[model samples]
Target: MRFEKENWDVIIVGTGPAGACLAREISKQHKKVLLLEKGQADLSINIPRMLKNNEMMFIGNGKTLVRGIRSGGTSVLYYGTAYDPPEELFSKFGIDLASEVEELRRELPLAPLKDELIGPAAQKIRESAVSLGYAWEKLDKFIYQDMCTPGYFPFDAQWNATRYVNDAINSGAVLLTNSEVTKVIVNGKQAVGVEAIVQGERHKLFASQIVLSAGGLGTAQILQASKINKAGEGFFCDPITIVQGLAEGIEAGNEIPMAAGMMFKNEGFILTDLTLPKLVYQLFSFQALRPHRVWQHRRTIGIMVKVRDGIGGSIKRGKVHKVFSEADKLKMQQGESKAREILQHAGAKRLYSTVWTSAHPGGTARIGEVVDPNLKSEYDNLYVCDCSVIPTEWGLPPTLAVLALAKRLAKHLLLRSYHRR
Candidate 1:
């Protein structure tokens, strides 16, 4: 492979929350860091841009999917709902994120949306859930209220990977945009560099440490390309369905999605408010074959049933092959039933879930199997610290947990001796 002129102390792949967080942390130690991004830089993250770009959306066999392919990754286009990863799972891997999570709690804007910020439809849904004794409560978010304007500008006011990317750059990290890393280059079981295509040209970058934080699918594919065993086996993506309803008089137009929800942890599902931006609402309406409903989008109310599913999947030829188990199907049905009950209570009619789609893909390359406790892979100096490292399907957004995991990994890699293969 051809080599670049510069050598880095650490080369991080993918600029998502996990990758960005880790890069910034390492750069703070004055290391020569390089961040490689698959997508182009300077791509504005907004509803319109997302709607127009085909590359931004990676759909797998019309089942699993992910969006927001750019310098900041999906964090740039998120709805802001956040959930903490189950601590026990990480503990089993000999890692803890409590301290890091605490630090972020104080730094990031993380709180439940205020009553004034909740939309009328969602408010009614919350009331109905409370009346039914489901213990539905406000969901934590990563948004700064004062930074947000009155309208539905999805790109602005949210805490995204871009902030950390900038922080890493300011702290002396070099970033290569449009550099799609295909695989880790291992020299006789020792990973020392990566081969990537940068703006139509192939380039090889060497580093003392190589970290892959390219979400589940991206990381899995990269590992497979390097002939890593079981790259995506035993992976899972939360099965989800959005139950749409029309609130008679309430205007839920372009409100924040997943404002509040009830969690039935043991039952493995959540009934949450699912409001979309105005244009996205119309797209959903059309996809539902209800073009007539476009006029009533302002009065539209939505309830999403996001449930954890059993882990069983394979990634071959850049595609994901997975099916929902009977247990998962049962949970989806239960969630739909609960959502319908709440929508009915809110005076909403014609309740229906648009379609079944998989949530963020993860657990592809697991902690105990693909990577060790320190997130180091089988090849020396190769590490993975993204959704791909998660060992279970928690059925929650992974930013907070992923960010903390990166911080923990950075500390471990610095404080401990590297395990040479």
Candidate 2:
């Protein structure tokens, strides 16, 4: 097959937060950047489109992993939560993101929801958990508060990476949607381009620098196809489940989810008040064989229990195979117990925990192994950024951390290019 004629200075695979941020920075410097996304660029929020964008993979028994395969990636489906990267985590690997994190704080809409924005379900759960001395409070969010109203969360109010992708395009970067990269085109020890399927046709796209920011599983699949045998060895997918209950006179179906929560650092889990979308609520309730409770979504109060699961999984042939350890199961159990207590304290009844699921799947192509602290792989000019590069097991939302890493990588690439010139 023939190669694309327009060679780029940098070819970024995946338009997730990391890739979008990097493309915006590089294009702003007048670099020839190409951003490729495996999914559609449509950002409409509707049930049919959302279900089509949401892709699910079965890892273990009754445990599934879900991610949004769209131009904005999973950020389109996330709760808009923000967690600062643990400085100590990256410090050990000789990387620092303090400056990038601070810059993002100024650029992005990051703050806790106001009292009026915090829904009644969240307020009741927070009160109960605080009364029990658990430090439950409003978690920081990446939301535009001016776009929201009391007890109602607008999807457009959430800050997704698509905005950065748009900025990159306006800065002269080329964005190709519905393009799935299969592997890197390497020449001996140097990287040259990528082989991808763009709208059902195979093509080779050349670039001086190639970065694989195709998220955790997607990146690992490409590395494996490129003969990187160790890319998909082990990984973590912050396992999560929701403890749901019926609370009389509580209307929570239309409220924002994950508005308030607390972290149990020692126990390796988190508890947050969650209000699932009407469709998701019905699906989960049906999955649990509670048909009678399906119509009670408006009165359902939910607490999400997310745990730091052990890393032991592989992505082979574009499929994930993982089994949570006994310890991971125990952590979930403990978290569910605590969530149950809080729900009961808030006068909820008939509590039930949903099946285990994971949204944050990462750590496969980790730093110190598949990639260096600079996020570069063994091949020259080939870098890996995103959740896959995170060096350790992480249970928190990774958007901010990945964005910081992308910023650092962008500066490194720009400096290297300037020196070459």
Candidate 3:
């Protein structure tokens, strides 16, 4: 790979939540930062179209799961559920979310979906949760609420990672799109730079610090290319299954709030609405429909069961291999049972379960496994900042948590640079 003398203070590997947040923070200090994204910078608000083409959507591996690959990364396709991290996980990493909560709130505030915005199907799911004694709450979303109009549903509420990417760029960080990092360049135990292929041409970027936010699969691929075997071990995505139930009175094509409410179980599992794009809905309907009665159900409600599994998966060469233990399977079954109960309460006629996959994969390059307490890889100056750095299965949406961790990591790097100064 040819070298460029345009050195950067920090070179971020992915333009997802962590990278964008870190870039925004570092650029505030007027530091030279280079953010490399593997895909194009398209921020279209059309969820159905994006889902169809698998362009900006999280289409799991052709076999089982759906993962995102684009400039905004998975956030561009995920249900915009902004969640708080598990306090216990952060304490283990010496991260203080309280210190950053105020700032986080300012950036990403949680607002309940208005009743008019949530369709009858979603409301039914909520009602079911309440009936079962399971606590259900409206989810906090990171969205530009005004853009979301009634009847537009998920389109109105989803704030893709492009928002943060644009913020980083506007804050003066240089963003290089369609740049896929293939190798982490290490020199005698200290990380020096990365070699990436942009437009089929290889380019090497050197930086004082490197943050890997290339997502669970991408990060694992980079580590494998760099001979970092520990990166993909213990990877866990909130393995989710969508249960579809036929709802009466609701139109089949009616729009529902992408994710209006959540039911967090005491067993570390969460049952929430699976707000799907039209294509996903069609697929689920096709699968759930019986052999002779494909059109029997006019309305469908989806509930996602995110199980807390003791057995996690691993990402190897951009593929996820999940090992569901008996206990994990049992937990998933229990979650499904609860979800069915909710749907039944909600006046669902026929119930069915879709295949399980995960978009929130974490713990690949977990703390103490691939990185240390400070998120530093074995090679100095190399850091993994995305969900891959999560030491345990967080059992929740990890975008907010990843951003907070990135902020702390950036602060740590800044302090280290200050001491060197």
Candidate 4:
């Protein structure tokens, strides 16, 4: 590939929500930006393709960590649930997401699922929880309701980071797929560029500023490789398991997962309806040694028990080392019990819990420790705007919070660029 003599204003690694939003905002301001993604640009939701793109690693204690390695990152596989960023948490660090969050609300399609759009399984579970006085409520989703229908979860109806990536592209940002960045090239105290493998070829890209949005695990590895030793010292992956039971005469399994649920803040866990796809259901069933239930996707009703786990992990030599604390186990146990009670109340039977798995891996490069309140690393012109920068144990979907942070980072970067000129 021929080299461009001019350096870009910013180079963002990863196409997840944070990177996408940042690229979109920065490009809209007419800044020269380069976006790199390690995964292919394909966004297909089929089983074979997703499995191929999803890199699953056994972190520790038999628990697995999975994240999409394709364009749009894990948001392509997420349930599109939108949770506001914890204001107090950010306020403590001298960061506030109020303006960015409000701007996002005006831009994105975010609302609770309508009654007609709620699937039978989620409805049944909600009914049971409400009957038990648990205060289960409909969750806000990033779905375009006009594009959705009853009993079916349409992929296009759900919002993902790809939308922002496309917007960024339209605004003249350049994107390079299959480019895996290895490390940032720091000159003295300032980051000047990065070294990456582009389409299996080693490529060195230069930029005035480098922002790593390569996710929790990916960013930690790159930072460590770049000589930031404290990048991945400890982390948290909010572990989750589904407590499932068979409900007779309910045509379930096609609805959106996590559509309705409640948080047990005191218990340090959350419960939500989780109707997995047929393939995923079968995979979980086989993993749990329940071959008899492998074919019960249509009749299975499940509630996900996701716990706010303590930070006790490290990203070392391309592997995740993690273990749950005793408190984490107790929280999951209590959540599972609550889920089973709801299932039983809803006329479900043969309850069983699936193996533990985690989707969000974060707290690796923490805010106060690794990154500053402005999300800047110790080196100049380097920043991190992914789940890795979240300083606390987060149990909810972090798409909204990540997007908000990206917006804030974009404003800061643009202002800094203007000041430099």
Query: Which candidate should be chosen as best, given TM-score against the real structure?
Result: 4
lDDT of each: 0.81, 0.90, 0.74, 0.91
lDDT tens per residue, model 2, 1-421: 2238988999999988999999999999999999989999867546556556546667878787877788988898788999899898899999999999999999999999989999888888999999998989889899999999996677899999999999999999998888999999999999999999998998999999999999899999999999988998989999989999989877778887888999898899989999988887887788788888889988989999999887897899987889999999999999999999999999999999888889878998999999999999999999998999998899899999999999999999999989989
Clashing pairs in 3: 59-66, 59-67, 60-65, 60-66, 60-67, 61-65, 148-156
For model 1, how does the per-residue alpha-carbon lDDT over 1-421 read when each residue is reduced to its tens digit? 2338778889999998899998899998888899999887754645556646533343444453545568888787677878887888788777778899998888788998877777777888889888987788999989886765444435566788889999999999989887889989999989989999987898888998999998888899999999896778867777777888877767667666788998888889877898867676776677668788878777788888988888886777776677677898899999899999988887888876775666567898898889888888899889999888888776878899999989888887766433432
Best model number under lDDT: 4
Better of 1 and 2 by lDDT: 2
Listed in order, each prediction's TM-score against the native is 0.93, 0.97, 0.90, 0.98
Native-structure RMSD, model 2: 1.5
Please identify model 2 stretches exceeding 4 Å from their true place.
Answer: 1-3, 44-54
Off by over 4 Å in 3: 1-3, 44-63, 154-157, 252-266, 287-298
The positional error of residue 166 in candidate 2, measured at the CA in angstroms, is 0.3
Q: State candidate 2's TM-score.
A: 0.97
lDDT of 1: 0.81
CA RMSD, predictions in order: 2.7, 1.5, 3.2, 1.2
